[model samples]
Target: MHQPTVQDFQSLKRILRYVKGTKHHGLPIIPGDSQLCTYTDADWASDTSDRKSITGHFTFMGPNLISWFIKEQVTVAKSSTEAEYRALSAATSETIWLRHLSAKLRLEQNIPTTIYCDNISAIAIAKNPVFHGRTKHIEID
Candidate 1:
């Protein structure tokens, strides 16, 4: 059921190479940790071709890697404001799913699942949600 094309084959080859490179990576879980925490990390603006950076993230519950995303954004952002907004949106989307997944697994989720981001503006925007000329276009809700 594999797609057949030169680009497809090349992409598969690249994926295989990456897997081969990180074959020994392991998730280290401590002995008796009960907290089911979700981690939303990012690697902004990784794409050199377009100013639209990629956001890389991974969610961990105790020691288990629950969810991850490594996709490039579609739009070209002018400032960190726009990039951080996109990153926040992406992290929030993953956090919602992580919360639902924690519930489904019968884990005791502490209220207010924290979405961690290094960007000060992103954190401010998430907290305030104030309607302003600059923030009116942010699609994160």
Candidate 2:
């Protein structure tokens, strides 16, 4: 942040272009129904250099895409399920923040936001916190 690099300049240019292209696009704020939904996924050991996983998620506000991101995980995940769980955790955090922000903005947000993840094993791990043999590594996480 202190020093701008070439990559930063290129990224800024890309953002400017995207903003210009979507200048007319705006999110609709409708009344009566306010719901929060999110989908999360991760690739196990996607980065060969550091063996780190990649986390990606998309958040929606009543069918409209409100937020999304894809980034390298801080720590390497031992299994695909672990990676997916990490992504789901991140999405859940965002969902909570968005819910609070919506309330602050006078939007009627319902409690208990929904988050979808593809990995059944990850879901199982989340559902049952009992540390099993397979999920021992991710227990502390």
Per-candidate TM-score against the hidden true structure? 0.67, 0.73
Model 2 pairs whose backbones collide: none
Model 1 C-alpha lDDT per residue in residues 1-141, reported as the tens digit of each score: 245899888998999999788877755445664454544444555577665777766666666666778777777666676676677788778877777776777776776666677777777777777633586665543
For all candidates, the clash counts are 1, 0
User: Clash number for model 1?
Assistant: 1
Tell me how candidate 2 scores on lDDT. Answer: 0.85
Backbone clash pairs in model 2 (N, Cα, C under 3 Å; residues 3+ apart or in different chains), count: 0
RMSD of each: 7.8, 7.0
Tell me how far the alpha carbon of residue 55 in candidate 2 is from the true structure, in angstroms, after superposition.
0.2
